[model samples]
Target chain A: MKGRSRGKVVARFGLLAALALILSWLESLVPAFFAAPGMKLGLTNLVVLVALYRMGDRAALGVNLLRILLAALLFGNGYSLAYSLAGGLLSGAAMILLKRCGRFHMTAVSVAGGLMHNVGQILTAMLLLDTWQLAGYLPVLWIGGMAAGLIIGLLGAELTRRLPPELFD
Target chain B: MEAKRKRFGRNDLLLVAGLLLLGVALTLALGVNRRDGREVVVRVDGEIVARLSLSEERELPIEIDGRIANRLQIADGAVRMIEADCPDKLCVRKGAVRYVGDGIVCLPHRVVVEVAGEDELGLDAVAG
Candidate 1:
């Protein structure tokens, strides 16, 4: 029974991971408005968050890693791998931590992940460039972060409500 | 049982207040502030492809492919490419968002035109 359950878990996570990659690619096609570099709708995050709520932290982490790898390869931007990894990992961690909190709703969890993702990306950029001056964008990023977080969080909240409960618990 | 509404905490209020202040400051600082004499950088895929610094008094028409942009004009102390071939025409409509936080991006063509006080600022922020 335990082995069967483990197989089911892996299969479910694999499916979620594939869905995330598809969503990531689809979002890339929606031309950005050019306010800044690396701006995205983060649709893949919605899948990951849904997977987290429906499955577990492990599944969410798996989906996150798979999506980043697939997106980097598909976009053909190897340099962005660092930024995406940092952002995805941090966001996933934040989401998992928020889930553990047991008080805040999915919207709050999504917001937390969104804010941390920006921070992670900025930190990665700073490390790659080897400069501290970029920190000035933190305020701007915070503003963008709030908006992005709210948007993604709202979507995640809706998904959370509609998702089947049996697989999540 | 009556469901209790969670009251906003001091930290939440502080965060919201900070956001408001920052929004106002950025709005005022970058609002309607044109950089006509500064250099414009066009970046694609984390690389600088074109650089234009227009200091001359005469206006120049920049044609992408064949058609001339309707509102793409740059004057002394301000630079703006107000038109493009993209379907959205958002960049053209942005009407020269020239600042650290302002940028006109053509995602379909992978073109981003932005005016900044210093190129180093962008490099440091994204590259650093």
Candidate 2:
């Protein structure tokens, strides 16, 4: 019974990955409403956050990674793969870490994840350019992260509440 | 239920406040000390193709004109476009960023104006 349940869990995790990829592609179709470069709705984050709550940690990680790779293949420049990978990994790690904390504040975790993604992306750019000058954008990214994170996080919370616990479990 | 008990610590507020103030200050400083004198380098695919060091001349030579080349200005340590054909002149209106993150981006042109810094020395090692 345990083995069968585990298989079912893995299958569900695969579905989550597919959902994340589709969300990623759909988000790209929506032109950024803001003026800042590199800004996007990041709608895929909703899927990742929801997966984190329902699917268990390994499933969440798998889904996030799969989405990043698939999304890069679908709509991103070849050169941008590294930045996206680094940013996604960093952001996902941040959110997971926050989730593990006793507080487990989903909203705060989302904000932290968003902020870290910006920082991670900027860090990669800085490292690649060998200049700290791009660091100036960090604050802008942080402010933007706050708003985006809050919106995404709250949405995640609502969806999680409505979802059948077994669907995620 | 578990996450709600945690409140933002003082440190978090302080850090956020510091970042905001820094962004505001940098934006203001860049706005006030606008200069018509500076040097600019345009790079694409991490290769430098155009270099413009400012003179007193107000007219700028635009090689690629699209909705992207709104208007150009060189101030302090930066070169920026104050106007553009792009419906969103956010790039043009940004004036010139003297510090890092200050770039002249022609999204339509796929052209970028990035401030060259000491890190240029490491470019060959990484990109090469």
Candidate 3:
């Protein structure tokens, strides 16, 4: 039974990681509606949030990291990899902490995660360029992040509601 | 585990609402305070390479490490990146920036063209 459950866990994480990679690719295919250069819908984050809730933090982190590396290798460069890694890790940490607090729902946690993701990316840009001029873009990015987060969070809530509870257990 | 099962509630609603309000407020504040910048400053690797008045219309080729990487065009009291050798050309696509805090950044080349001088709102310092 132990071995079977371990295998099941691995398979589940693998599936989630695959889903994340596909979502990232899809996002890239779509024309950016926002004016900002790095703005994204963060579709892969939905999978990370699902993993965080259904499987565990370790699984979520595993899926997030794997998805980032795989997506970067496939469609992004070293600079993009740095930005995504920083954003993904920081956003994941924020979500985990907010979820643990138990005061807010997945929607709120996801919103914070989205905002922190942008913040992380901006910080990475500033660090790499060695200037704070990029900081001017933060407010616009913040608003975009919050809006995307709200949408993703609502979708996450709906998904959680419709999925079989046993899967999460 | 049981705690994780709880659904969205009033606190969540309040948190979302508060964030929404904050987002709107920041947007409005930034928008309202924006003013046309007087000069355009081009920098490479964080060093100021050139500073030109926006009132003058001209095209400036930006060279980094002894190679021409970008072209800055200032016309009609606005500045823009009309050309860039970068793969994505994102800086060129950013279009014209006229406001004091507006900027165009080419990440690949590590080049930044930013507006400067009076009417500065000090947003970057506060936010950074």
Candidate 4:
């Protein structure tokens, strides 16, 4: 039973990771919609959010990291790797913490995740290049992130409802 | 405290509103000091490489390791990255920056171009 369940966990990770990568690719195909640099629909968060609520943090983080690495290799570069890692790690941490609190809805957790993700990316850029001027760009990203997060969070809430928690909890 | 709250309920709405307010407040505070600048400052790997006046029309290639990484163009009192060898080409897509706090960053090349003017002093004051 133990071995079988472990296999299930691995399988779950693979499925979710693949879904995330597809979503990333789909988002990239859409031409830059907004003038704001680095603004993204962050469609992959749908997979990560669903994993977080259904399979927990380890599962969600596994999916998120796997997707980032695979997507970067296939479609991005080293700098993009660093940027995505910063955003993914920070957003994952925020979502995990928020979910653990048990006081907020999935929408709230996802929204926080979205906001912190952009914050993390911008912070990484500032540190990497040693400039504080990027802070001015933050407001635009924050608003855009919020809009995208709201949509993602709504969808995530629905997804978590349809998918039951897996056995690994 | 509302553990039994529904998804995107009053609590969630309140949180969203609060975050939006924070974004707006930040915009006002950070934006107040920014103004169109007279020159663009280029930095390579965190060091100032050039300060070119925006009034002049010229193109400059930002070189890294004797290889041109990005082509910067200055015209109409604005600066844009016309070309970049980086994978994302985000710097080129960022369009033009004319405001004092606006910047075009090419992360792969570690290049930053920003506008600066006499009011650039406001930047230090704001940071302080």
- Ranking the candidates on DockQ from highest down gives 4, 3, 2, 1
How many residue pairs clash per model? Answer: 8, 8, 0, 0
Model 2 CAPRI quality: incorrect
Q: List per-prediction Cα lDDT, in the order shown.
A: 0.65, 0.65, 0.83, 0.84
Candidate no. 1 TM-score = 0.63
Off by over 4 Å in 1: A1-4, A33-37, A101-103, A119-144, B1-74, B81-94, B97-128
How high is the DockQ of candidate 3? 0.45
Model 1 Cα displacement at B98 (Å)? 5.5
**What's model 4's TM-score?**
0.83
lDDT tens digits, residue span A1-169, model 2: 3344877877887888888888888877765566565666567888888888776567677888988888788777654677778888998998888787645456667777777777777777766554434545555676787668768887887787778765654
Per-model TM-score of chain A alone? 0.88, 0.90, 0.95, 0.92
**TM, every model:** 0.63, 0.73, 0.83, 0.83
DockQ for candidate 4, please give it.
Answer: 0.46
Per residue, candidate 4 scores C-alpha lDDT tens digits across A1-169 of 3355666767767888999999999997876657556789799999999888777789899999999999999999988898999999999999999889777788888888899899999999898888886786798789878778778998988776666444334
Judged by DockQ, which candidate is best? Answer: 4
Local accuracy of candidate 3 as per-residue lDDT tens digits, A1-169: 3344777777777888999999999998886556676788899889988888777789889999999999999999998899999999999999999888879888888988888898899899999887766867878788878778878887887787777867655
Q: How many residue pairs in model 2 have overlapping backbones?
A: 8
Q: State the lDDT of candidate 1 residue by residue for A1-169, as single tens digits.
A: 2344766777777788888888888877887664544556678889988888777788788889988998899884755788889999998998898778666666667766777787898788667644333454566565676668768877876766766655544
